[model samples]
Target chain A: MSDTKRFLYVNRKAPHGTVYALESLEVVLIGAAFEQDVSLAFLDDGVFQLVKKQVTTGIGVKNFAPTYRALGDYDVKKLYVERESLAERGLTEDDLMEVTHENDDEEDVSSIEIVDRARMAQIMAAQDVVLSF
Target chain B: MKFAVVVNEGPYTHQASDTAYQFTKAALEKGHEIYRVFFYHDGVNNATRLTVPPQDERNVQKNWSELAEKNALDMVVCIAAAQRRGILDEGEAKRHGKGEGSANIAPGFRISGLGQLIEAGIQADRLVVFGD
Candidate 1:
C-alpha cells in the first residue's frame, strides 16, 4: 500500500470564536511531518482566518494568524481559498495575507491557488481522508 | 471496510459526539472495522473521567468507554488539545508536574499525538469527521 495519502482539511469556521481554526492548523502542521499529500480548504467563515492586518490586542488572546505564513516552512504548500467564500464576505485576494512557499523543483517559484467552490468540492471528493473543523 | 472517526465537539453541549457514537455503533454492528476514533479540539473533553452527568442523563463518556472496550477499538484523545483543555493522562500529569490525581482520562481512551490522526487518514478506507 502507498504510504502517502491525499488528506484534505476542510475549514469552515472563523478563528477565535472557537478553537477550531487554531487546532486545525495544529493538525495540519503535524500532518505535514508525516509526508502525506496534504491540502487545506478555507471556505465559508474559514476565509476570515487568512485575512490580513488582524489585531488581537483587544482580544487578549495570542494571535495565531501569523502561523499560516509559516506553514510553507513545514512543506505544507497547498492552501486553497474558495473564491465564492471570499466573494460572499466582500473580500478579495488582496485582503488576505501573502502566503507563499518556495517551489520544491524550482527555488524561486512560489504561489497560492485560489479555487472556486466547485473546484474545492472536487478536491475534497478526491481525498483519501477528509478532516473538517 | 476500515473506518476512521474524528469527533470535533464536546459531549452534552453539542450533538456531534452523540451522533458520532451512534454512527460508530451502527458501523460496528455492520461488521465494519473501526481503525480509530480521534478526539480533537473540544472533542478531547469526551475522554475525561471527571464528567459528572445527572442520574437521568446519558453519560456520554461512559458510553464511549464501554463501546471501545467491547469492540477493542482505539479511542485517541489528541495530546495537544488534551493539554490545552486539562485532559491529562497518568504519564502526562506526571511529566507536567501535575498531581497524580490530576489525570482524569476515562477507560479505553488513550492520549496520543496528532501523528496518529494522520496515520489514521492513511490507514483507514474512510475518514468521517463529526463536528458542530
Candidate 2:
C-alpha cells in the first residue's frame, strides 16, 4: 500500500432486510487486499450482525453470519462493537461470534473490541476516511 | 482537493444519487477533483442504460453519463453489487450467457471491484458518502 491511510467502516444497520451490511462487508474484504489500515465499527443494529448461530435459510437468504470470523485472515482485525448497542439489544460479548487474528508478535488476538459510545466517537474522529453504511 | 464519492442508493426512489451528482458537479465547478465515485448496494442501478423514466422527470443515468463525459469523471459501479442487483456489463453479460443487449451499463460507468473504492479512499482528500 502506498501511503496507508486510516480507513474506518461504520456499519449501523441490521444484517438482513437491507443490503447495506453485506455491501459494507464486501468493501472491507476487497480493501483488505491492499493491506491498508482498516477498522470496522458495528453500532446500532449492526451489532446484531455478529450474533452467533444466525440461520437464514428460512428467509431464503444465505447465512453470512459465519463470514465475520474470516475477517482476521484479511488483516481486518479491528472489529469494534459499541458496548451500549449490544446492551440495548440485550446481548453480551458471549452473544458475539469469536473472531481472532494473529498479531505482529504471532500471538492470537481477539479482533472484536467492545467500546463505549464515547470511545466510538473518538474512533470515528481519528480516521482518515469514514465510510458509513 | 481530491474527493471520493460513495453512492449507496438506487435512482429515483431515493435522493442519494441525485444529491451526490449535484455535489460532484459542484465540486468540479469549484475546481476540486473527484478521484472516484464508487457505486455500491442499490447504487449500481444508476449505471444501467435500460431505464426509461417519465419524460418530464430527470434521467438519473443520463445525468451521470453526461457529467462524466463532460468532466472525464471516473464512475465505477461495483461488480459484486451490480451482479446482485442484475446490472451487467458486456463481459458479465457474455459470461452469464445473456442475449445481446443484456449489458445494461451506461456509457460513462464501468464495472469494477471494490478495490477501486479503497483506492479512491486512499487517494482522495475527502470521501463523501450519500445513503440512507
Candidate 3:
C-alpha cells in the first residue's frame, strides 16, 4: 500500500450538545497538515453542522459552522453530504451553508457534492482510514 | 491487517470502552496487528490506575492494561484530554509539578498528544472509533 492514505472523516452527530463535532473539526484541520487525501462526510444529525444561519449567541457558545467554509483553504475539499440524511431531517441542499472550494484547474468551478446513502457507503468502504466522530 | 482504535467515552458510564475492548480482543484473536488504541475526550479516563470497581464488575482500566501488556499494544491516552481530566502518568505529573502519587496511568498506557492519533490514522489500515 502507498504511504499516503485516503482518510474519510465520518460525522454522524450534531455540531452542538456534544464535543464530537468541534473536536472532529479540530482533527480534520490537523489532518490537513499531513497532506493526505482527506474527505468529510456529513450524515444523520451531522448535516446540522453545515446548516446555514446557525445562531449560537443565546446559547453562549461560539458558532463553529463557519469553519466548514475554511476547509477549502486547507485543501480538504471533498465534502459528501448524504441526501437521505438531509431528507430524513426535513433538510435540503438549500438548508446547508455553501461550502465551496476554488478548483485548482478551473478557478470559477467550485461546488459541494451531494450523494446518496449507497454512494456514501461505497466511499466509506474504499477509505484507507475511516475516522468517525 | 493493522488496525487503530479510538475510544471516545469513559468506562461504566458508557459502553464505548467495553465495545472497543471486545473489538480489540477479537482482532487480536484473528491475528491482526493493533497499531494503536487512542483514548480521547472522556476516553482518557480508561487510562487511570486509580479506579476501584466492585468485585463483581469488570475493571475496565485493568482490562485495558492487561490487554496491552499481553499484546504489546500502544495504548495512548491523549495528553490534552488526559490533563484536562487529571489522568496523568508519572512523567507528566512530575513535569507538571504534581506529585508522583497524583499520576494514575495504568501499566502499558502512555500519555501523548493528538499528533499520535493522527499518526495512527496515517499508519493503520483501519482506524475505528468507538464513542457514545
Candidate that would win on DockQ: 1
Query: Which stretches of candidate 2 lie above 4 Å from their native place?
Result: none
True contacts kept of 2: 1.00
Q: Tell me the tens digit of each residue's lDDT in model 1 across A1-133.
A: 7888888888899998888999999899888889988888999999999999888899888799999888888888889999999999999999999888887576633346789889988998888888888
Model 3: per-residue Cα lDDT over A15-76, one tens digit each = 87887898889888888888889999999999888989999998888788899898988998
TM-scores of chain A across candidates: 0.94, 0.95, 0.95
Q: What C-alpha root-mean-square deviation, in Å, does candidate 1 show against the real structure?
A: 1.3
- Where does the lowest 10-residue lDDT sum fall in candidate 3 chain B? B99-108
Which of the numbered candidates is closest to the native, going by highest lDDT? Answer: 2
Q: Comparing candidate 1 with candidate 3, which one achieves the higher DockQ?
A: 1
lDDT digits (tens) for residues B80-118 of candidate 2: 999988999889999999878789999999999898998
lDDT of 2 by residue, A36-126 (tens): 8999999999999888888898899877778889999888899999999999989999999899999999998999999999999999999
Measured over all alpha carbons after superposition, the RMSD of each candidate to the real structure, in angstroms, is 1.3, 1.5, 2.3
Interface RMSD of each: 0.7, 0.7, 1.3
Error of 1 at B84 (Å): 1.0
Cα lDDT, model 2, residue B123: 89
Sort the predicted structures by lDDT, highest score first.
2, 1, 3
Q: DockQ numbers for every candidate?
A: 0.92, 0.92, 0.61
Docking category for candidate 1?
high
